[model samples]
Target chain A: MKINFPHRQFAHCESGVTANLLNYHGFPCSEAMAFGIGGGLFFAYVPFVKINFLPLTTYRIGPGSIFAKATRRLGIKVIKKKFGSPESAENELDRLLEAGRPVGAQTGVFWLPFFPPAYRFHFNGHNLVVIGKEGSDYLISDPIFEETVRCPAADLRKARFAKGALAPKGRIYYIEKMPVHFNLPKAIESGIRDVCRVMLKVPLPLLGVRGIRLLARQLAKWPDRFGEKQSLLHLGHVIRMQEEIGTGGAGFRFIYAAFLQEAAGVLENDRLIDLSRRCTAVGDLWRDFALLASRVCKGRAVGQDSFDHLAALLSSCAVHEEALFEDLRSALVR
Target chain B: MKKNDVPQHSGLLSGNREVNYAVDVDGRYILESSVGWEAKNIALRQAWEAIADELTVVLAEIKDGKKSALAYHMVKNQMDPALLSQYSGVARWRIKRHLKPAVFAGLRPADVVPYAELFGISVDELRFVPEELISPLAGLDQVEADNS
Candidate 1:
């Protein structure tokens, strides 16, 4: 028997899962609200970390973070687990599904058979909800898609235990108890403050707004250091991380802007609504950087759009984001 | 982003339309269904091209018998020796050594079982790659035909 679970798509997976799961448990939450309340925005360009032989350029916090943070702040008790073996993991998941509790599962994108073959890569951190099991297939509520999906139990097992870099190890989580009384305004305030603090005050140069600048510096030097082919590959990875597979670059910014717009209504603060528009403007700058960088990657730029110019465009994003976050902090103060 | 400005095109080749946040008439943020965007597609294409390039080079090396079938599988799966070792419980050095055609040829069925299991193939299937590693971009044409 399939548990009746409402499936709704969102721009990002973790937030979407959180929103859907919370909505199921009696708290009506949108994906944007979940993301904003969780303070899911992050920017890190660490050269030391490598994925598929390229340096890491992540736009948001890793998977599972949003659900964990959003739920914790909202005073929802959740049971989270990671099994040592795939067999144990499968048993636990099956048990939960039998009990009529829809489970949030973390899996690698590569082994999920339902995904478009071209889009499947070995990136290990993807989230989905499994609501039912019937005749060797599990029904899935993957947040990135419009409708629900299904996966064979064997393939689902493989995806859950997919190895290498952020392996899921068959991790499963679900809410234990949803809080009926929690401070929504305080949650919104803390979440916005966390975003501002991380954006503006992170001491590390390879994180926050500072990280954007670091990426800018490294990006300009790529052509000389790694040659044209490798530099273009690096550029492509950055764009993919931003816009591909819902990693949330400019897409995330717009989502956050939407969240802020909603936050304004809840808090009855007009400044927040204004700040949300500025957030969108900052997101636009990021989109501009992606467009220009893509042209550079395609070698379609005739002139004035060199890596140096791209660097300037990216640095501009960092500058504007810094300003936006600083303004956000003051907006939260009153 | 304006709702009108949202890219209504589906993914470059994925045949998926995704929700993107844009603004409505009164400037409220609304989720728009984006077919896809040119810039994002180009980036995705570059990745596929890189994979195709590496596969071509690896396939040539295998034809020359300098590398084993395992080498082709590894590159095709985007796995390095270190990563493959971690998953298959084989030592990285041994994985690298096994990539040599002669060494792979000397391996027994039992010795190849771990790799076959990891790749979800039989020991015999692991012994050789197909004549062609089809470019993922070509799948779009297949998808188009299926739709039509």
Candidate 2:
């Protein structure tokens, strides 16, 4: 609940979205974005189809697979840093790991935060990405999956991962560009990289738009001297500077509800009712019914329910019969 | 129903002198002979409505292909084995013991097909009845299905 932004670098909508989307498509765990997007996709049962989640594993990247392809497809670079407590040996490996990178580069530095007692669920071990900086505060997209939050760079003064004499007192986790393959599926690569596409937060354009623009601006400030596309940063700045526009962003809320209904329904069809039960973002009953219909389409055994049976379930939620049937019919096409 | 008067056995209890049997398919015997004998006809004609009734149901189910006919071993698997033993008038183990001989006595090797025709269950599932006893089970099924 305590959201804090950590210092980090840039993010792109098109590449990041497409890459991670592709990576998560076949993954057993649903895909979620740190900010902007909160919901992840999952298929409960594949009547005939099957997919392996191994391609998404961090340890398996190589030349020909989708993992390697994502790095090559997008110009995203990766860096890794390991942390050690200074009270131990005099090994120079820890210093060498943290020394070389340019200080203000628009780089996503992966670092281990000071293990907070409040955040320790399973041992204090964690992995996080620092994507931007606001004054002295580090803007981060933590993969903690709770909420996108920020914390002070000075907080890292106690940071075990930093390099110093007592630096060995803390630990440093491996940092890298969120492996692009870890971001999007290949199909939607060009359209929405860098921007986090969360179905749950789809209606909140402010959060979605602000999060991405800040990332773009941060990336633009990177010292790596590539003038490839300056227009991207300008656009990011324009949007990031805006006030809470359009009816306190209520239209965004409507769209968010529609998406939630669809997403929750998607979750239900997969027998993932627990996820729907946990969701508090959306308020639409038709979406819930659609989730049920989606389950049947995904080949779950809902027992002898025909199209008429489907329409009857939808009717309970006050959805029009024709529209319900149409949605049910369409869910099957996938 | 025609009944057979009790046969006389020497070791009898004080009050009861008769213990009647109702045998329709041929007759029931309490013989101690070690050797088998050829056919010798002794007529005590009685109609067994049981055998006639069961055969009627089995024949109908078979004709319509609702029941896939199988060899004794496979049929034994589907039916309750205890029932089969009771119908055959044999000890339970003897039912398993004589199964091959029973199947071979009535049917040819080419007659039984595997999964395509009948489901292969264990021999325990079979309900055995001598040709005469099958009727009561058939009536039971009809009664139960009707009630359901």
Candidate 3:
């Protein structure tokens, strides 16, 4: 017996899953609302950490943070579990399905058979909902896909237990309780404030706006230091992380812009609308950056001057974001 | 991006195969499966090509007995030693030891089982590098060129 959970395709996984789960529990949450309330938008470029041998570039906060923060803000109680063995994980998932609970799970993308061949990679932080089990196949709602899909039990097991960076370890989470009413304005304000602190107030040079500037500095030197092929790969990785892998459109700048537009309506604040437009412009700049970077990746070298131009573009984005978030923080305080 | 500004393909072969998430004309968030999505796919394919090229070299090293088949599979699967260690529940040092051709040849079935399972291959298959591993991107270049 499966709970008739609605499957809606979304841009990003965690925020999408959080929105679907919250809606299933009677919250009627939108994806943007969930993302905003969770304070999901973020950026960090840590050269020391690597994913697939390239420097770490992330468009959103760490995996699972959105769901955790959103639920906490909205007063939704959730039960999260990680298993030591695949057998126990499968058993628990089956048990949950039998009890009519649509469980949210974190699994590696590489082992999931339903994903398009090109999209399948060894990304362990991918999130989906296991809505039902029929014999040896489990029905899954992967937010990135166009529709619901089914995965064989064995493949599901492999994906859930895939080893690597950000391994899920057979993690499953589900809402245990939902509040009758949530204070949307308070949660939105809190989310806005927190993001402002992260983007504008964070002191570390390796994070927030400073991190973007650092990435820019390093990007400018990539062509000279690593030569053409390696430099292109580095540039390609940055664009791939920004556009392709669960970015929710334009490195999450568009999503954050959408959130700001929604917040403007909710809080009846005109300033947020202005910030939303500015954020959208930043998203456009990121798109332009990706287009240029993709051209470089395809062996169409635009010369060394192109690298400097791209770095300047990134720096401008950082500056605009820093100012926008600062304004948001002060507006929320008022 | 605006709806009008969104890239659209027009020609004899005109259909959007890739899906993208963007805002629609109604100011509602929607998924637009458009030809523009292929741009990102091309980028992704290039990244994979680089990895496949590395794996090709690693496979040759394995075949020449310079490195073990474990090294070939690890590179083919886009995994590093630390990641393989986590997946197999094997200690990093032991995994490193198993990367030597001599050490890998002498490994017991029990020792080889976890790596095989992680790679979704049999023990024998894990011990021998496959032919496809040598030139993994053989036809990929043609497919990409055709797409462009």
Among incorrect, acceptable, medium and high, the docking class of model 1 is medium
Total clashes for model 3: 0
User: Mind giving the per-residue lDDT tens digits that candidate 3 earns over B27-110?
Assistant: 654556554454475577777788888987887787788899899888877888898888788999999999999999999999
Model 2 chain A weakest 10-residue run by lDDT:
A51-60
TM-scores across all candidates? Answer: 0.97, 0.20, 0.92
**Alpha-carbon RMSD, each predicted model:** 1.6, 33.9, 3.0
Off by over 4 Å in 1: A247-251, A302-305, B144-148
Provide interface RMSD per model, one decimal: 1.6, 42.5, 4.3
Instruction: Give candidate 1's TM-score.
Output: 0.97
Q: What docking grade does candidate 3 earn?
A: acceptable
Evaluated on chain B only, candidate 2 has a TM-score of: 0.23
Between prediction 2 and prediction 3, the one with superior DockQ is 3
Number of the candidate with higher DockQ, 1 or 3: 1
Model 1, A1-334: lDDT tens digits are 6999999988888899999999999899988999999998889998988877888888888778888888888999999999999999999999999999999999999899888766788888899999999899999999988889989999999899888888998999999998879888888888889888887898999989999999999998888898889999999889888888674448489899999999999999999999999999988888898898889889897233488898998899899898889888998776
